[model samples]
Target: MPDYQIRTLDDADIAAADALFLGTLHLPPTAAEQLDNLRPSYVPGRALGAFDGDELVGTAMSYPSALAVPGGAVPRMGAVSRIGVRADHTRRGILTALQRRQLSSLVEQGDVIATLRASEATIYGRFGYGVAERVRSITVNPSTAEIRPDLPRVGRTRLIDAAEAETLLPALYEQIGLRRPGMMTRPAGLWGIWRVRETKLDGLARTAVHTNADGVADGFVTYRAVKSGGFRAELRVEDLHGATPTAIRELWRFLIGLDLTAVIKAGSQPLDDPLEWSLVDRRAVGVDGVTDSTWLRLLDVSAALAARSYGDAEPVVIELVDDLLPANTGRYRVGADGARRTEATADLVMGVAALGALYLGDVAPSTLAENGLITWSGEPGQAALGRADRLFRTPTPPYCGTFF
Candidate 1:
């Protein structure tokens, strides 16, 4: 094992961290240039790098943000991004050391939880990060899809230029509120990257705003069109947000009404999209795929458990094993009242990472138990697991619309 020191990143280290991050993915420098243009989200004294005698081999960056959980409580969370290890440093324990240092720093800084979008599914479990949220992609044949008359359509949508969108969208998102459990408040750096500087979406995408009956901007969808042939066109959605059910319906109406567009594709949509039910022909909406989005790690187990609301079920004692953050290893009694450390024997045993996976109510405890990710103290523990599942379940499956 190489002796490497993990420390906070500074202004002088940005270029080096960016280079190694891009280099690890085998991407060109153009990507780094694109990253440079966006406002840096790195929190001072939180961005960490593992250096082997001053040569940077690994980097992980974090920023402060509030993560919305059940019962409408938003807790301060650490949002980690651009985590990577130099190609040659793989399997050498450098990644582990960097994560440990980052998690430790977050705990000291009073962050209750840490979250990241994992590039690979298998990479972060050992570090106590769990898949806390999921998103799905949908393909709609717009020409055949029809909105049912019963669904209220009180809003009128109109196209807006990029500059106008830049001014309105951020405020619209705030007005709409981060109402979902897994949703987050987007920082200025992320908004600048997505709405202002056209990187992945590029400059071709157009923004459409939905106005209420009183002519107020409430929802918007950013999408782009591509002509594949003389008669065929496709509309790809870049981003979409709605403040109300009527706003959502109106926005979809506008998207489907666009002429020459046969196929409409959108990703990162909530699992319970009303567009499916709004259609006259339900089969027109095809679910292309679903993938994990937000990976959460509870930096402070006691605080994390107490932050979110639970169901009106009987309390259950859980024994959590945290390999990286050993201080979190203990039994906790969690229920509708809130969670607290308890000296009683645990009804269930799970890894800290597994607990994080269930923190946002994305996956149920019973489901994890069926998959052997959880261990019960008794043979027929279905009742206890059922109660725990209800306590952790949310009205909608957790979905994080914000990328960072």
Candidate 2:
């Protein structure tokens, strides 16, 4: 017997585990902040890892988070991130054991979904996790961001200190979280993660905030300029959060207006975000690639949907189909009339993975229907269902600043 088993982590395992992680991924050991945030001090071992005797081979961690089903409320979610296996232990059942235990444990704890950023695109798809969202990196020649000087400005903008983000970020995040599904809740100390990434760039990163008419810091943009080969500038955006469209637009405008930059590279954007459309030369920017940002497991999709506010009108009765988890395979009635809940109903239905795909608007009704993911009664029902179906992202795109 190879003698391999999966179990909860322990603080004593940190040093060895960190070493194992670095070796598995073939990257230089990260700074204290990256490791600390991923494996918190309190839970030094909150995650599960596979071991062979005293040797640590496979590890995975889950962060406390949430998922908002538009038209319903937010449900507590566990984000399974930083999953890795030792290079030497390529096969065997280490990964399977870890993931199986993690998913079951999360479901047992009442998590509506278990999300993660899949490193190996081929790995997680087999674990019943469908592609829920996509992110794209853009390399823009900043010297050419020719933002219209008089671009119809909406809200007052100010350059807020990164330290101030702690107090302001949560409010803005909550507002956006309601409409987006793949968002995660940032705990107190974890608030410093964004700042650390910025500071690591040696002052090249900058942030700009937007305040509403009532004087609220509703949004912020974090970006940095790094050296590029051939003397071209490479700017990467850490994060951008805005409560209202007006604020988001202005923050974007501010970013576009940055001076003396050669290239602006941004990632973690939503697929259909309108930021590219806002540019004078639409084709100037190109999507690097569309990779899944979040994977969802519908532990209780019904409860997830009934807890949030939805579209502007009436109600929708949907039969949700989950091929993996049989529990969520049923009918759910969601309405924006303030009454959101799942009921045993006799009606049409859609697959859980399809809903996950729709979670980011990556999948549309006509396409889902065409693919048999959902049945469209007629043109009217199709239109109503599409409108009633809320997607989780802004026009700028939803990007998790950190890989987690």
Candidate 3:
């Protein structure tokens, strides 16, 4: 018999769930502050608990959100977060059961996809989640970094207080539409936690805004400084948003120009951020880290495939092997126009996990084929794979700025 049962979390279960999640991470709750900051964001019916009779052994939840895809398509997605299972319950089927319940619920609610930031690299692939986005950690030496002369700037910058930042940043994020794939809408509750509850400033991180000649805000950056050594400090950026390329350039220039700060470091930067290219010495900016950021699982494969626009290429039929969602186990023809179910023989075959990775256009077909993740059917299969690559190519790599 299964040792635990999975069900929707209730109000009474909140404390236990929070305790389990925080305890597993070894963080104690604040004495003066409760999880009141998280209460407002608690999505009713979206959280699930796995219980060993009266005891809660595991927890997981998802916030309803939309994920921006290539060609300006935004699909309804469930942002999976706040997941934890008690250490003692390790290797039990509890986690698998909870995941199955949540993912199934997401599909029933018509969610096209589910995305999560995996705590470990090894856990999610078995559940059909594939690495769909990447983030880079960058360190820039401000003294040696100079903006290239040819890079034009149209905006001036000014500092702002945290109060002003909380009021203005979200609006600017909305104004800067999700032009790139992998970006998602930051819901209001998350904004509250990010600006007020989290960060070193304790809700008062130093903020700066970029403004055009007319004095309209186009970009903003939130960062804090820490003394690293004698006469030197590190400016750690919390978040940076730009409405345009000029805005991005201006904000970056301002951050690197801060006095007393010898180095500026930021995590979760888009892999394609042009900060290095715009600098006089590209070597001044070092990629200190790189890692997979978002893992995506397609719940409704047909709708997921049709939601995003593709590149100009001939339609290619590929057979999918989906054990979790058996309905997706079939052949589909995909092209620049869109994707559709097809009865024709598939030229290529792959598991759903591999398909999710290819969905973002970040993983090339050639790479997948070389890695043995893809199987070719005929002599013409190689050409079909080529066509698939063209259709999935994106001008920019996919990146999700939101952490959850």
Candidate 4:
């Protein structure tokens, strides 16, 4: 066995981490820029490389993200992605040391949770992470699809040039990410997503804007058109947000009713999204299936609690202990604002990674307690813990738009 040491990556490691990431997947180091776009929260120091003497053999990267839940907003969820160990380093406890080191660092900083887009579903479970939501999809006929069967709504659909996307799209994603779950921040290069796929970026792709009483751009959808016997579309909703129903409906209708051939494909939707219901014919909607995109692992419980906004309610204290990710061992008193008010007088501790999943969405505390991942001090305390979680519940299960 070669000598090994785990250390926080610095500027020098960017080259090595990029090399390992690219080589394992057989891409050039240029992918570092692309993957960097996916990781808006990456700090070189926060990303780690497991080294064997002079060679970079493995890596584990995490970043800041958010989860959309019912009633209110939560902030700063840590999403773990791009975790890999070169084949040569496998089964040697390299992964174990890397995670242990990362968890220890996160615990010291006081962050409660973390998430990931798992490459192998089976691998992360042993670390105490679990799937919290399923990202579902829909395929539609574009020829038959139209924003409105007849004319336009209060909003308008325009074939804006790609250059305009830099200004228009990011504003729209802000609203969507704030109100929705399992959504992560978009990278700077996202503005180029259209052109890489098409030359004009407007042939099949376009933006539909919904404006409110004040005439502010509220929500938008981006899609590609395919004309067959009828038109077929694979629509990806970049972001949809607004203050009123008309604004939201207008954007939804614009995409679904676009002038096309027959079908449309849309994915990464929230479970309770109203788009399907807005259609007069419910049968027109079809669900491909629900699947998980974001898998969570808790880094630190206290910082995780205090990072985002929560709903209004009385405060509750709960103790937490961890197994698989041992660094996150502590008791926490969570507040109505979703803030951490105090360290628990004692540690309602569960596995660190399981807490990360629960933070990503709603994984009931009692079920885990029953499963023996946690020990509830009392039924009332357990009930309080469950109800306390109401703040992080999502209108839809968390869904990531792209694979990490």
Candidate 5:
């Protein structure tokens, strides 16, 4: 028999669950007012708790959102967050149990995928999650940076107050839409949590919006300034989204022109951001580091495979091994036409985690095979690996800039 029981949490159980989660992070309990502000963001029937008799020992929850896959298909995805287990319960199966239960629940609700920003690198792979996207942390010397003379300056940017941000930002974000693979639609529940964190908890963030020549809002950025010393400060960009290249350039131009800021730092920026090319002096931007951002798990393998468009390549049969979701363990034929289950022999074999990494086209099949994450069904050759690589290749590197 198991030592703990897992069940969905109710309104009355939220406080205990929150406290248990906080304890695992070595953080203090949430204050009454902050908790009150955060309570409604929890979607009913989504949060789960593992109970050791009457004690809440583990907690996990997800927000309902849609992920933009390649070829402009938006599929339902569960944005998982706040997963934790009590420190005393280490080495036990409580964390595994919670993950299994949560994944099963998400599958039953018809979610095609699940994703999370991992707090640690080693925790989630066994649960079938894979690092799907990567981001770079960049620091710019604003004083030395200059926008190139040839870059278009078609848009105008203006700062907005917090109250205006609360109303205008969401609408502008929706208008911008998900133009890139791995981006996600922010639902009301997720937005509520961000609002609480920005306004109630931190209260230091600011916003700026960009408008096209016709005076339509097309992009926005949120950031906070921190004093570095001696009257100089560093501006940290929290979030930035743009609908067009011109809008993105204009927004950066506005930020570079801000007063009293010595440097600007932005995290989780896409690998293909044109900021460097737009600058007259490319070395003005310094790359601090690159890190994993979004980790993805394919809940429905067939549906996910068919949703994204593929590059031109001959068909290749891939045999998937899904231990947690046994129904997905089978051979699939993937090509430019689409993907479907096949009875023919597979050319290559991989596990679900490998599939997740390959799904977004961030990592090529050849790279995964070289890393020992994939194997050949027969004798290994470059033909199959090259075909798979071309089939899954994307024009731009996949990036998920949102931090849940």
Candidate 6:
């Protein structure tokens, strides 16, 4: 038998769990004051700890939230975070146990999906988590970049103090709603941590709200200006969202117009960000990097498949292999109409991780098949793959701007 016992953590165990999690990352211990501020974000019984005898050796926790899928379906999801195994307990099956328990709890609690920002790309795939969304880090030379004259400017942006930002930003975000697939509704628990980070941890971060001619708030951005060297200041955009393209353009105009700013940088931006095209010189904006943003796991296969809308394509049967959750290992026929379980022969075969990747409509089935992540079970494999690709295709690429 294993030495560690997995159990639900209580409020009193929050500090130890947090410390253990931080220690695994080689970070400093959490300050008493900061821990107190973040305590409420840790919901009671949401955290799970692996105890060896009486010491906490592993930790994993998630916050309640909802994810927006294609066709405007918002299903319950768990925003998983703080997953770590103590140094001494590395590769001892502690983390796997914690994940098993956590995933089971999420399923039992009726969360249709679970999402997490993976610290390492390679760690979560074995646990059935797939890279569902990708984001780009961009650096724009504001001095050389100029907004195109053809783009309409119909909004004004105003800077707000931290106090006002604390109150207005959340409401503004809700008003804008989730316009893209993979976007999630932030709960108060998650917002509490974000608030502390922006307001308390980052002193340089500032907020700006955009309003149209009607004087109604429609968009917002939070950024910080940091001195890189002599006479050069880099404006790092932390969060930016807009209800309309005009509002986004105006916000960019304001940032570009900031005096004495040398460069503007933003991470976790959507792959299809319009800022580049809006610029008079498209090359003025450089791609710094592209990285995975959201690792998604579909806790319920049938429900998740039916949740998102599909494109017009012939029906294709897909056999999903889910080892951890055996109940999901079955054949499912997916088409534009909807998804349902069927005993028909599967044309395409893939694991649950590949399904998660395909579910967001971010990556195409043929692409996954080409990459050897998927295999064919029936004849005319290319045709079946093409059908699957068209069936899961989305107009806009999936993007999850929220970082948890």
Q: Give Cα distance to truth, residue 326, candidate 3, Å.
A: 1.7
Cα lDDT listed for each candidate: 0.84, 0.64, 0.83, 0.60, 0.88, 0.88
Residues 215-265, model 1: lDDT tens digits: 888888989887766776788887888887778788888898888787999
Model 5 RMSD to the real structure? 1.6
Error of 5 at 165 (Å): 1.1
Instruction: State each candidate's clash count.
Output: 0, 8, 0, 46, 0, 0
Q: Model 4: residues >4 Å from true position, as ranges?
A: 8-16, 23-42, 64-74, 106-112, 142-152, 175-177, 180-214, 225-245, 306-319, 324-327, 333-349, 367-404
Residue-level lDDT tens digits of model 3 in 1-404? 27698999877777778778766767654332545656644578888999999899889988888899988889999888878889898687777888889989999888999999988999999889999888999998898988887877676899887678777888888888786899988777677556324532332258888997678888888887777458777888878888777788889888877788878888989999888888889998999999898899999999999998898999999899988878889998998889999999898998888988988888888789989988996669999989989998888899887775
lDDT at residue 260 of model 1 (Cα atoms): 79
Which scores greater on lDDT, model 4 or model 5? 5
Q: How many backbone clashes does candidate 6 have?
A: 0
- Which digits, one per residue and each the tens of the lDDT, describe model 2 over residues 319-381? 776655667776666555543346655244667666655554445555667777677576666
How much is 87 displaced in model 3, in angstroms? Answer: 1.0
Clash-forming residue pairs, model 1 = none
lDDT of 4 by residue, 1-404 (tens): 34778888875566567567656665545444454443433465568888888788998876544544334445445556557789877899888888777766655544456667766788877776777666667764444444434433764545566567657777666754454555566544334432332442333565556665566677666656554443343455544455455677776666665543355666766566565555656556678887676676655555556665555556666665567544445666665666554554633655665566666555656566678766657766666766656654544555455444
Greater TM-score among 2 and 3 belongs to 3
Q: Comparing candidate 1 with candidate 6, which one achieves the higher TM-score?
A: 6
User: Cα deviation of 50 in candidate 5 (Å)?
Assistant: 0.6
Model 6 TM: 0.96
Per-residue lDDT, model 1, residue 104, is: 90
**Positional deviation of 165 in candidate 4, in angstroms?**
1.5
Model 5 TM-score, all chains together:
0.96
What does the lDDT come to for candidate 2? 0.64
